[model samples]
Target: MADPLSVSANVAGLIGLANEVGKIPVNYASNVKSAHEDAHCLQKELTALCHVLEQMRSLLREEKLQGTRFEETAALVSVLGFTNHQVNELYKKLDKLSIQANKNKLADFWERIRWPLKKDECDKAMEEMRRLAQYFQFSLTAANRLDFLSQTK
Candidate 1:
């Protein structure tokens, strides 16, 4: 069985990364004109993902799964761990496109004017994120209805 506290920590980390990625679209929007619609779509996806994560975090806290050792708990933890990895990778990919505030004004201006992600890449990322968010939400709902402690015995 997975430790609930540790799983909660993973959820927290993913939430933070999601928030960081969400901010990128907004920041980039100020400088990039061509990607306005894409940025808005990405932002909405991130916001939805973040909302799901926050709900999961609250579920973890309210349920206090520490004393229960069950198969379902393990499965939930697995999903969380995998989602954490995916979100981290997405953050890295998006972060690379971010312009640093300390960079040369001209360089910053140019970087901001250009959106680095190709259309396919943006679509793929958004699709994957949407899928993961829905999966996590399903897992959370299942977790709430199941009795893990009895199953372990």
Candidate 2:
């Protein structure tokens, strides 16, 4: 949210992270099947988040000046920054599991696969993603309304 270009880049980075979530290996051991399921749920949530972030990016692009509604624009930026941080943390947590799995594969074929996140952790992350997306969606809708009102004026 520092600049329009940076905002777009941050959104793109988030989308990229969401896409990477899909690439996570899900063929986990039977003992950790729940975690594997959690990964799928997380992937789905991230996909939804990606769509929401894309809509946000479009809104930012359309309202380059952010118009005369300075307070709303500033609030949107704050939410965006917070959302970015949360998603990045989620990605890093998942990435740690993926990295460990890869390293273990080289050590032994029979090594037990373990997911880094518990069900509650994944659920928390997904909930946060949904909440952030909803906020962004609301902000985008409000911005669109403001834009229409200004044009009509």
Q: Distance from true position, residue 109, model 2, in Å?
A: 5.5
Model 1, 1-153: lDDT tens per residue? 545566667788889988998998887786566665777788789889999999887776665566655354476777777777877777776775675765488876666667667788889888988998898888777875685755877
> In model 2, which runs have C-alpha deviations exceeding 4 angstroms?
25-35, 63-73, 100-112
Q: TM-scores of the models, in the given order?
A: 0.80, 0.73
Clashing pairs in 2: none
Error (Å) of candidate 2 at residue 59 is 1.7
Best model per lDDT? 1
What lDDT is reached at residue 78 by model 2? 74
- The lDDT of model 1 is 0.76
Local accuracy of candidate 2 as per-residue lDDT tens digits, 100-125: 44456654333445677877887898
Lowest summed lDDT over 10 consecutive residues: which window, candidate 1? Answer: 64-73
